[model samples]
Target: MAEFLGYENFLVAADGAVRTVRPEHLRVLPGLGEHDGEPGSCDGLTLEGVVVDVAFRGVDRVVTVDADDATGTTVRLTADVRDSALTASPGDRILLRADAAHVVALAG
Candidate 1:
């Protein structure tokens, strides 16, 4: 996961760096959603990627994301199938954002 987020800015601590990002801090945005390269101060943590695949977990949808930043790392996240206006799929460009508070760093 750190490999996939090599391009992203993360908070560092004396113990270690953040490896996993909590889902609560992450927000999945539609491709058509408006935004700049990075999430603004008001906005949450954001990541851009392509949908490598999608799976159904009962009523939820698990999305496999390949970071568009070109790190070659793929992340799997879940969301309610009935999110906002749009949903994600394979080959679709998508965005994921998380608040700094919700994103955490762990010592391994």
Candidate 2:
């Protein structure tokens, strides 16, 4: 069984391809905040990408996206819904923004 690592509060799903967790889970390491001269500010860093995969775990929906940046990174975002209709699907283009605390994807 795959060992679930520590939970990430923020993420973005890419391309709807399940099992590909590559670039989605990358996070800025601690002590690299804006006060320390990081390029992007600690809060409100933005990324644009194409939706790759979408998954559901209990009440939270996980999405994976292939980013269109130099890093070519993939991201995952989580959404909690009162009902299942809120779930995202494959082939969706999305924009995501996040602060130091959490990542928020703007549904397109």
Q: Model 2 has how many clashing residue pairs?
A: 23
Model 2 C-alpha lDDT versus the unseen true structure:
0.43
lDDT of 1 by residue, 1-107 (tens): 65465433343333444445543345567674675554452533456777777777665565666552224344455433445345677888887766656555565
The TM-score obtained by model 2 is: 0.42
Model 1, CA-based lDDT: 0.55
Off by over 4 Å in 1: 1-16, 32-44, 68-84
Q: Ten consecutive residues with minimal summed lDDT in candidate 2?
A: 25-34
Q: Report clash pairs, candidate 1.
A: 18-105, 25-98, 45-97, 45-98, 46-97
